[model samples]
Target: MEPIQLTTAVMTIVNASRIIVQFMQNQRLKNQARRRQQHGDEDMNTDFSKATVSSNLEIMVLLGQAHAVERRFWARETSTEWWDHIVLQVWDDSQWLRNFRMRKGTFMELYDLLSPALKHKNTKMRAALTDHKRVAIALWKLGIPDSYRSVGNQFGVGKSTVGVAVMQVANVIIELLLSKVVTLGNVQVILDGFAAMGFPNCGGAIDGTHIPILGPDHQGSQYINRKGYFSVVLQTLVDHKGHFTNINVG
Candidate 1:
C-alpha cells in the first residue's frame, strides 16, 4: 500500500512538472517575440505567425493553471459542438468530503444556469468565461458574504462581480447548508456547551434584534417592521455556553 501510494504521488508530481515546463517554454517564446517586435524588428512571418498563434501552449498552461489554482475538486464534460460544454464540482468539503459530495452540479450547466446572459454576446468570450477556475472562485466567494471582496481582489474582479457570483451560488448553499434543520451535532460542536445550559434545542438559542439601514426615497413606509423603524431584523443564535451558533440577515 505504501509503495503504491508513493508511486502515485511521484507520478502526479512528474505529470505536473511536465505541464509546468511546457508553460515556461510557451512564455519564453512569447517573451522573445514580444521583445523582438518592441525592438522594431519588422520581419513579419507569414505562415509562422499563424502557426505560433495556433500552437500557443503557454495560453493552455495559463488556462490550466488558472483553473488549478482557483478550482477545488473540479470535474467537467463537453458537448459535441465545440461551442457548448459544462463543468461539475463540489466545494467546502475538505473535512466533510469523506461523508459525501457536498455541493453538486455540472459545471457548464451551472454557468449556464447562473450567467445573467445565458448566451455570451461573443462565442469566444463565452468560452473564456466558462473557465473552471474563474467561475469556481467567483461562485465560492459569493456564497461567503465577507470573503467575497477579499476573494474577488485575489482574482482581480470587482466587488459587484463577486456579489453576482454569490447570488448565483447562494441557491446551492441554501440547498446544502439549510436543507437540514440545524442538526444537534452541528450546533453543539460549533457552539461548545451552549446547548445544555437551558438554551434552545440542540444547544442553541435565538434572539431578534434591529439594525439601521439606509432610508429609501420612493416609499418611506416600506422600511417599517413591527418595531416601526427603518431597520433590518437580524437573528442571532448562540449555543448552550453562548458561543455564536448562526446568524441570519434580513
Candidate 2:
C-alpha cells in the first residue's frame, strides 16, 4: 500500500474509536441521574406521610380536649337562699336600714328614680336582678367598709358581680342625681343659717379629706399624702342642712 493511503486509514480508525468512547460515557451519566431521581422521590413521599400522620395526631388530641371541656361542669358555692329567704322575707325594716344605711321605703324610692338607668334585661343565659336588689347592693357596699368578696357572700352574688353592681349604681347616681342633689339650694337661707350659728357671711362650711386610693400610673409618688398612704384630696362645701353644695376631688 502507498504510505499516504495507510496514514489516512489509521486517522479514520482513531476518529471512530473516539466517537464510540464518548457515547458510552454519556449513557453511564444518564443512568446515574435516573437512579438519584428515584431515590429522592422515595424520600419525599416518606417525609410527606410522616408529616400527615403527625398533623392528624395533633388534630385528634385537640378534639379530645374540646370534648372533655364540654362535658366537665364546675359548680360554685353560693348563698342565694340566704338572700331570698332571710333578707327578703324575714328581715325587718330596722334590719334593712342597719344593713343598707337606708330605710326600706327610702331604698324603694331611690330604686324607683334610678330604675330607668340601672335596669338590665333578662336573657336566656341568666335572669336579671330586680332594681330594688341592685340598689340595696350599692347601698350596702357604700355604707360598709368591706371587701367585695365579703359583700358578695352576704348578697349571695359573685365578687365580680358585686363590683359591677356597685360601679353601675354609682355611675348612675352621679349621672342622674349629682347635679340636683348636691346644690347650694337657697343660698340666702344658707347664709342666714350660718349667721345664726355665729359665723358671719358664711354660706357654707368647707372641709377637706384624703380619700384612700390605689397608686396611679402617672406621678404616683405625688399621691402619697402626709399620712404615708396613697390618697386623693376631696374638698367639699356643705350648707346648713349638711347637704353638699360643691365638691372637688383630685
Residue 239: error of model 1 in Å?
Answer: 3.8
Question: What's the C-alpha lDDT at position 17 in model 1?
Answer: 72
TM-score of each: 0.31, 0.64
Candidates in order have lDDT scores of 0.53, 0.78
> What TM-score does candidate 1 get on C-alpha atoms?
0.31
* C-alpha-based local distance difference test score of model 2: 0.78
Question: What lDDT score goes with residue 190 in model 1?
Answer: 44
Give residue 118's lDDT in candidate 2 (0 to 100). Answer: 81
What lDDT score goes with residue 161 in model 1?
Answer: 56
lDDT minimum window of 10 residues, candidate 1? 80-89
Name the runs in model 1 displaced over 4 angstroms.
1-123, 126-154, 158-160, 181-203, 209-214, 221-231, 241-249
By summed lDDT, which 10 consecutive residues of candidate 2 come out lowest?
Answer: 66-75
Cα lDDT of model 1 by residue, 31-111, tens digit = 776778777765633334654665566456555544443212432332322112222322334522322223333444555
